[model samples]
Every structure is written in C-alpha cells, then in structure tokens.
Target: MKIILILVLFNLQSGSEVITAEFDDARACDLAALRTFQGVTAEPDMRPLDPAEGASAIEGTVIAHDSDGAEIGMYSCNPSRSDRREG
Candidate 1:
C-alpha cells in the first residue's frame, strides 16, 4: 500500500508531459488527454479570454514588442515569457 501510494504521488508531482493536447485559440481552451492507465483521460478545457485585453489570465502573457510595448504602466513584459509563465 505504501509503495503504491508513493508511486502515485511521484507521478502526480513530477508529471509535466502534457498528453496529445491542444490549446484552442478559438475558445482559449485546452483539450488535454491526461495520463491514465485504465482509460483515455479527457480533461475539461479552460474558459475563453478577451482578445481585446493586453495580457491573458490563463498565461498572463502578451505579445510584447519592444517598440509598441510599454513596460512603464500599460505593458510590463518580463525578459522572457517562460519566466512569467512559471510565476
């Protein structure tokens, strides 16, 4: 029982391999196929985002250009989007 529990915990925590999933630009959702030994896992997608908005809630990222982008107040993009994504 302890071994089984440990294995489950390990998989859940270390899991980063997103299955053949896709983030939909149309609805701003993801059709994720999670890992499941017994069956084909199909998780629900996220809600859509407002295209008009600068940053997105799901990723909190924006298409930042050095010229058009503003870091003072309106736009504040990090050095890398990956850095912001982790936060």
Candidate 2:
C-alpha cells in the first residue's frame, strides 16, 4: 500500500508539472504583426454606404497561413479571385 501511494503521488506531481510547462510555453499574439503577415497593409474604410441605412464594407486580400509560415492560400475581394494549395 505504501508503494502504491508513492507511485500515485509521483504521477500527480508529474502531471502538474506538465500542465505548468504547457502554460509557460503560451505567448501573447501581436495583432499588428499578424495583420501584416496576412497582407492587410492599412485599415479599411468604414464610411456608411447609404444615408438611411448605415453600412460599411472593406475590400482587400487575405492569405492563409500554413504550419511552416508559408502562405497556403489567398483570396482577393476586388478581382474576386481565390487560390488554394493542395497538399
């Protein structure tokens, strides 16, 4: 019974350490850097379209990210074009 208790305590402590290490690896994301990587150069126009109804629209391109920081795909609003890569 003593040996079993020791093993249980060891497992619990090891599990807690693993959880703490995972939290330590977490980092805050930089919004500006992420936008720049996605090809969003500047803020989009948000002016109202109609006088009676208030609406806003933005036209730009979007690039998808892959595992190795490579652009996996892209989509454009102005030309209505979309390009995706197949694994």
Candidate 3:
C-alpha cells in the first residue's frame, strides 16, 4: 500500500500540457517559425472550419511545469486577439 501511495503521489505531481487558442498574428507567425526556441516552439493546429464558421481561431498548446520539472497541470491557451491589437 505504501508503494502504491507513493506511485499515485508521483503521478499527481507531474507536469502537463494543454492546447489553447492564440489569435495573435505576429505571435502565431513566431510560433510557426519554430526557429527561436530550437524547435521547442509548438505549432497551432487550426481547428476545422466550415462555411458557417463565425470566427477564425488558432489552437496552441501550453506546457505547465512543476518546480522540479514534474508536470502538475495541463491546459489549453485560448489567447484572445486583444493583446495583438494592443501591440
């Protein structure tokens, strides 16, 4: 039981990642370039769209890291285009 508990705790304290939306054209381009971070830059997998699509959105992943590099949380980044407009 002790070993099982330890394993469970270890799994709970791990770093994780998430897919998010980023509409920043410039930032999107930078991420798309994948040149600045030695290929660590994640690319946005555009969601499929249809004629009925209301707005265009880009999907990006967010990597959440724990203190010791242990994935603790994972989530998506849906960065609204407001920041881009401000810049």
Candidate 3, which segments miss by more than 4 Å at Cα? 1-58, 79-87
User: On residues 64-85, what C-alpha lDDT tens digit does candidate 3 reach at each position?
Assistant: 3343454332223343434345
- Compose the digit string of candidate 1's lDDT tens values, residues 7-34: 0111334553322212323122211111
TM-score of each: 0.17, 0.21, 0.24
CA shift at 50, candidate 2, in angstroms? Answer: 29
State the TM-score for model 3: 0.24
User: After superposition, which runs of candidate 1 have C-alpha atoms over 4 Å from their true positions?
Assistant: 1-12, 20-46, 50-53, 56-87
Candidate whose TM-score is highest = 3
Superposed on all Cα atoms, model 1 deviates from the true structure by an RMSD in Å of: 18.1
lDDT of 2 by residue, 58-86 (tens): 33333334445433333222211122344
Error of 3 at 54 (Å): 29
Of the two candidates 1 and 3, the one with more favorable TM-score, higher being better, is 3
Candidate 2 overall Cα lDDT vs. reference? 0.26
Worst 10 residues of 3 by lDDT: 1-10
Error of 1 at 61 (Å): 12
